[model samples]
Target: MQDEVDAVQRILSALADVGLDSITFVAEMSSTGRSVLHLLTFGPAVEAGIGPYPGSLILVEGAVPEPWRRRPHPVPRAAPAASVDAALLERTLRERIPDATGATEAEIAAAEAWLGVALPDELKALYRVTRGRWQDWGDDYAAAERVAQAVGCELFPLDELYVASALSRPCPWRFAATEAVVSPPDAAVQGLVGSPGWIVFGDNGGGDRIAVDLTPGPRGHVGQIIMLDHEQNIGASLLADSLTNLVVHQRGDRQSSYRVDQPTAVARVNIQSMTSIQAAAHPGLEVLSIGVWDGEPLSLAPVTGLPRLRTLTAYPGTLADPLEIAKLSGLEYLELGPEEWRVLLDAGAVPRTLSAAGIEVHGNRHPLPIVALANELLALWDRPPISQTILEGHVEV
Candidate 1:
């Protein structure tokens, strides 16, 4: 097999030889230490080189031939020492964030008026650092979360993981950074300070399942309130409100992987995103409501041993297997969406412990069955669950 650098050269030579403009190759290491290649090319030029070039078929190649074309996972490095200017950052927020002036003041009184909480020292530092412009990796949610991490704030693990993954849909929020760990059963989800800034939990395979979401509350308190969206389209969100903390994903660049710390509070747990998993391995879990969306697997793989899960709401299209649902035990609510609902209906099975206040499926209007499926979902709700559902009366084609 060719070495990592050699593999990169081979791919680049083929692309450059054919005059393929705006094409670049991203290489990373899979957890198994195999090389993974993500070919990012667009427009019509790439069509010509298909036959004589790489071993894989066109569109975009995820993993390369022989060597697999992966790169090493980036290790944490120290951030360049920079000075913090609270006054400057506060001024920047005042100019940028609508009503941000109200969020920061010389004292807690002024700060509370804006952000609804006394500014913690760590939070203050973070806000000061990223008050105005900071580097973003394309996703709006990821950009906002990056701003939150600049200080010492942290996201609750269960919510953190789910929201990061919910962006699996073709939206700006899907830019996620992940790190996998296999610890003892007794291991808890520690390293809040150092864990990958975000975690996503949903299905990626081809079924509908419950959607998981996280809604940020006052002072980041995590007020326990869950909202369900069974449309199998809307991905959930759990964001870190500081720009100081950072996480890196396979798709990101060197600058995107750095660690930044900020301050945050455990606000009300808004079930903006909920999965079928009933419990988390870590303590301090605050659950709100359950919803459904087409994203990643909400259930745990038997090999992963994720148990003690309580609530789940997801679409079936996010996971590799359907039987992973057995891992969750305490699911009180469910919203199966369209794809998962069909599968569940076909299987003639539902979770034995399932008890939902209501059920909704998203019907689709597009030519694809999922479009009718999304539209069907709207009928189940007394009101639209999402504020922004159909953009210009045209759902994504």
Candidate 2:
């Protein structure tokens, strides 16, 4: 679900207050030299490990009134509970990661030795996980957006984890993390049938990154997607070029294996995990979905690699190739995440095809409207034009 304008603004302001400044805005308005209230701070908040803080990470919404104002956004909230004991959790993690130890110094030393870099003073204050060989480091580890300037290390995106806390969602960390503990999804559990969309679970399935046997609910199925929670390796997963209906994985566990049971022609994968799904180019591939789990600054490559790729998930950050892909012969589906949707709507990129072969996104609510619009548009394209006026109305939050 999306965040309320006020909540986002307050969060952004807090980021700014914390001494972050270098920023990037990926909204449609940002491209047109316009502005949306949301902002993303980048670079080191400080320089030379000394004086004058560079800038703050501020994603503020402009002071718009009414509909444009920051409204309460919906999200999947978790049950409220006690905070995890940092010391105990630390020990548990140490046991799981092997290198992580109960002592902070040992863990810090291990991170430094493995990652081949010195830990920033501030970074040491929080938990640190090295990007393992098979790990993607997207969902599992919430990196700080703005790293310490002196270290010259890239800032990690930890906003998603923080947002989970603000919304009172389940601590994604508590999910089966260690390989020994994380078992494969049972066939009986295969497919989330009750869910509106297809869901794929990733586990300790070795080189087979995705375990697709989850049970589905009675509700209508939109399509299949995979969730690779940082266990599989990107290059290895792509090597199979299986193109399962959906893909999902987390970050920091790239070594995990992923497999594609269906042929590329049969399935269109939507990957929300930090890893990119477009491995080999296939003209038949319909959609390439991506999302920013927290606030990690990741890029989505255009179908430049995939000749058949038509629909692309709209996430924040600049596109490697927009015009080129816009000209794709049969390109159609283009949906945005909660963060990118507002920008897409404002940018007026909603093509007639958007009415059909539409994009799906994550929010507190369902996206039946987008699907309906796409169906209507496709119907109109085949026959005579139908009045789409009814859909022109704004969706009530």
Candidate 3:
């Protein structure tokens, strides 16, 4: 018995350095008096390569006291509190934006009835603080909206709460038919359709939408927010785990809700003014489509490190030389603007290994001039005259 107690004491002392907080032990003794002890320790320092749930268990040969087999006493706790504090959120919003106004209970109730779904408690708390609108707080706090707009959605609007509520019958605005030009395959389309309970609340002023997914796809969870890009052929990319997370994020909390398991063809979307840090974080990108609304010259230097980049769509002023982009051996598709195409053709620097190559020309002008030139230049290479419409009447080849 002395030996058994000494062994346990020594074991506890050894584990003290590892932050061991609690220990439970069990023992079994044979008729010959030999015994075995099983000790389970909680709050131990997790070892390298350990999984999310970490703990330690030790087995020692000894006769332990019967008291060791009993369960440990329960820990005490304080009274429960709301996960989100409505008054605190309101205070924060008022501090940041003096014009912020919270939604009234009647407004929230009406909106919920129109949508035919109850808002999650956290989201309800958020609305009670602020209806849905908040000014761009700054770079860090506004990163979500910036990333959403870059991918395809317009400014994240809180007015969506009221507008979506008004258009509740049949929910025409609930789903946007993806343009056939950038649509995913039938299976992927079916997967998206399976989760038809998406409520679009805002747009990019173009046509793309930002929505809260009530019925998530196979790889997503309900209540998660996603961006639906109708123009770029990209389907849904998760933006936040929940509306509550989005609100928390805007308060300068750095957490990622970006989910990347979409169909490969429409999986990647480009962000304007991308930095090397952002590119390294999204190494799974399959397509890099640059959009520069500022008309300032863009650079492809930041994305050269992407190991999985398969498609390169270079807008005007994005590249100084075609070879600078052709150097990426993994790139399978290349789309270039007129001037870049001319430079590449002139220098014979266009990589012949590309699966598809085309020139992109923007505007509503007669395609005869550009089409004739495209055929002349691309006919020898056996490529198609791929033209995309930037606007209702403006075509980009």
Candidate 4:
């Protein structure tokens, strides 16, 4: 350990010879071992991770970018009927691929029991005509292709069916706070991360999943088809009004119910944007991002009482009074500089409502003080503090 520390000191000493104070080293770790390391990157360190500064401490655990803990929204109404007959949908698949294999009644019942949710009649009927398990087709690509061509999707076998619960879609609080779950009264699908009523039936072959939505929006049928988009963290789009409709290969487009109802969900204050906080302030503002500015630092007074405000990110030195952040009782994400955070921590003004936070570091600054400030913020939520190890060594040079 001593030898390794001494080696780090020697390398850092050589890098410091370039005369830049904040030549930071960033090492981002991941469970997948895709961890990245920038050997001698310049600038202040805002991210949390492990990086040693020669004789000083290594940056440890960073704050969680966002925490996910949202539950599925309750569905008060029963699912409406599919637009077509289950029996007809079954026959259509049989006629399209008469030689295809299907799931047994006992197998179907077992699937329902396993999932703890009853399979909709149309899905059950479709599977009865063509069970899409890979083992059923062996290594025969033609069989799978035939099934996909018949069902308009790569179908999941009865045993593989699952409930698309909200927890299955992990989203960070920072990004989730900005999502608006608004379904038009006539909409066919509810805009949500996932629903207990959603039963996975197949895939779009492009990573998106096809599910039978039991919790329909105001105008949707109970067994309508919905697509759980892979790229989206929340919400599904309507593909068909019914399972039978989906089997017929007559697709319909349905969009996610997530929309920015108000124009000010996110406000950017900079020379090219809103230009001032006063102009950015709105009753419905959810995020306030203060970027680089040539003018004087701005005050948070204009947006203090914003009921919906949850995210505030001010560039270092851009806020005239950082303490005013305390007035924001609804903040979920807050990002500021080391000095601003110190002011907040010293005054005990950090908002308790925050679920995630960030630090904005600019120019060249040592990371130890920044790490100290980050640890303090993390401690506010009883989050694991970034550990530090101090190493003392003199450069041989």
Candidate 5:
């Protein structure tokens, strides 16, 4: 690892020699026989299927990843349950694991006090049967497996129970801005990265979490079991109506599935998605990403004056007029090539409305100009500038 770090320092030093402070490496599964982690899985992977912190983390230091900055748009909870059949749930667990020991009433109350919310009676009943700690089962794998099978998930301990706060799941800016939280009118589970009301109490064997949904969707029952997929950065799926249903019935509808490809919410004017910016234009469009184009440079006139367009990411030389970006009044995030940024900076056309921006460096570009441009954008917001630490040394390849 130290050798690898040294090599990176050497590369960065070489880049600095060419007036560059940072670079983003591309990932591919092509001619090279060697396999490296790319936009696909190898081991632990980014939920968005992108290389971690893609588009260069080096220069974006002062900028916080968008996820930590994101606020969950308000989601009104459905009415609470009149009551839960705690006795039935307790009977069911005892039948499944006859020797299981449960959490004390005091322990459960302590958890509620720590989380600042009363847990449903159904959840409390489950804990009363088995605390679900490894220590409770000791080194007996069979005992642990029996409990997991009985509960339909590997349960978290009473002390470990936590509110799956949305702030807990932070993603890079490029990805966080692209996702949308969707809970259909008839859905049982609400789509969100995290929620204070989601009392996470178990795991689905994989990294995905199993939680008791205190804030359910319009059609949902309070205290329904939900699974938050680890591979996804947002939302969850309905697993069961309650803990009793999960253990006894072993069935739960994976109720909600969210897709982010809304022409009104997100538009990709590129060869990979749609063909033209003109086609992507709409009043409700919030993000406009323009990618590789070999034909004529496109005009931003198609999307000008769009009230909801808050993000615009254009590839190098894709914009016919970078100044056209200024016409986008609601833009909070903008990413452009150095040349395009230079155009905006030179004309004093940089939007004062922006909260965060990124510089897209393509090819063997000099870092000096990009660093300078990054500083200029940071200065606009009184943000701390990107600082480069110089290291001079010869690294053995």
Candidate 6:
């Protein structure tokens, strides 16, 4: 593990030398007990390839690989773009509200100075295109624009950063009551505890503020984008690894490979949007599925009170320990990602109770529509599979 970590750091250092900062490295132990490193980069991985390293390394740029790519699952389509460039930002803004402008370099610099922190490279590049302001510059013009009409302002002005950092004023729109939590304010002194090094960038048009971490937290790294929802008390929850990844998520470019179904009252619950409070509300859930993407590991502790939970499906990494699921006495089925499934299978640590129920491994199959697969799985459950002995005996009879 030490050797793998050293190798990864060397690779990152080499890439940084070549001016590549937007990247994510994940090192996992393979079924063979060898460390396998996966590199996710906004730019070309080929360009940052500093080879002659140990173990297997897969580099993915722009889009997800074939196996992991969300297949057959229909998602909102976004315009084609290699990376989060000025053109893509402009196009996204234009498609929603024509004539939307970006922030100027001076405005960006000013905001940085006011906040006492340098903006990330992706954000700096974005603001260099234009200074977010109105063309008409009047009440009528502001009222006419769709973004202003929807979000109360076309874009968060550079001046707002000053108010947000110093006074910690209320954010715009629905988040008007929510205070902007930035780095300058000492977490210990202010009694404002949660993310110690977050800088609010803009609002998501809802009550949530889109912020980035200047200081790395346990959940995410520095420059990693997080969603701050004061209303829900969700502070600096990992939204994406970087601005580029956030753009991809916003555009619905990255889709979940697994299929999902609408919420029903059959004790089978979809906890994609479920919060800790909401989890407590649904005490009758028999089966729970949590959709975890590239974010912090979600806590299953919230659902410990669910007495009837039989099946739990989520990314294995999300749990501190797979045994945590055993806390739910009734839990039967354990569905996990393909990689995780292999690891557990090799370790032979799968719980005896869970093994008695069944263990379903997701992935390693052709892309199937989620809805179709759900219906098929349900149908199979409704009428259990016949044993070969029964069929052979019937044929002889």
Clashes of each: 110, 62, 4, 3, 4, 6
TM-score of each: 0.22, 0.23, 0.31, 0.75, 0.78, 0.31
Q: Cα RMSD to native, each candidate?
A: 20.8, 21.5, 29.2, 9.0, 7.9, 21.8
**Candidate 4 overall lDDT versus native:** 0.72
User: After best superposition, candidate 2 residue 80: deviation in angstroms?
Assistant: 62
**Residue lDDT tens for model 3, 9-96:** 8877876866664444444456665565544332112111122111111111221111112121211221112334444544544554
Q: Which candidate is the best by TM-score?
A: 5
What residue pairs are clashing in model 6?
102-130, 102-131, 103-130, 103-131, 104-131, 267-286
**Tens-digit lDDT track for model 6 on 1-397?**
9999999899779879979664544454545555545444422212222221111111212222111111111112322124444445444445555554557667788888877777766656444433444453455454345554332223455556422231242221111111222221112111122333466656766766666555443222456555555564222355555665555245212211111342322232234555442443355555556555445565567677676555566654555455455566664455554445445445654434432122233444322222222222223334222111111111111
Candidate 3, position 345, lDDT = 68
Give the per-residue Cα lDDT of candidate 3 at 140: 49
Cα error of candidate 1 at position 169, Å: 18
Each model's lDDT: 0.30, 0.30, 0.45, 0.72, 0.72, 0.42
lDDT of 5 by residue, 1-397 (tens): 9999999999789879967555443332334444332221111111121222223222233444333344444446565444446788788889999998899999999999999999888888899999988887887999999999888888888999989877667666666666555555666776667777799998988898999988777777778888888888878888777766777666656765454454346788887788988888888777888899888999999888887787789999998889988888987678888899889989999887765566777876644455567667666655555454433333333
Candidate 3, lDDT over the whole model:
0.45
lDDT of 6 at 297: 62
Report the backbone clash tally of model 4.
3
* Overall local distance difference test of candidate 1: 0.30
lDDT tens digits, residues 1-397, model 2? Answer: 3568888788679768978543333222333344333233223211111111111111111211111111222222321113222344333334444442122467557655644434332234334432222234343333221111111223222221111011121111101010011112321112211111111223232323232111211211111112333332111121111111111111222222222453343222334432444453355554445445444443444355555454455444424333333454553344443334434344544344332222233343333343333333334335322122121122233
Q: Could you tell me the C-alpha RMSD of candidate 3 in Å?
A: 29.2
Q: What TM-score, to 2 decimals, does candidate 3 have?
A: 0.31
Q: What is the lDDT of residue 122 in candidate 2?
A: 25
Error of 1 at 41 (Å): 49
For candidate 1, lDDT tens digit of each residue in 1-397?
4699898788678868978543534344555555644444423211222221211111112211111111212323312113223354444444443321121335334433443333334334433334322222234665555333422122222211232222233211110011111212221111121111222222222332212112222222121111212332222222222221221111111111112232111111113532333333233221222234344444444323323233443433544554555445554333444556556545644455542212233342222243233323333432222111121222232
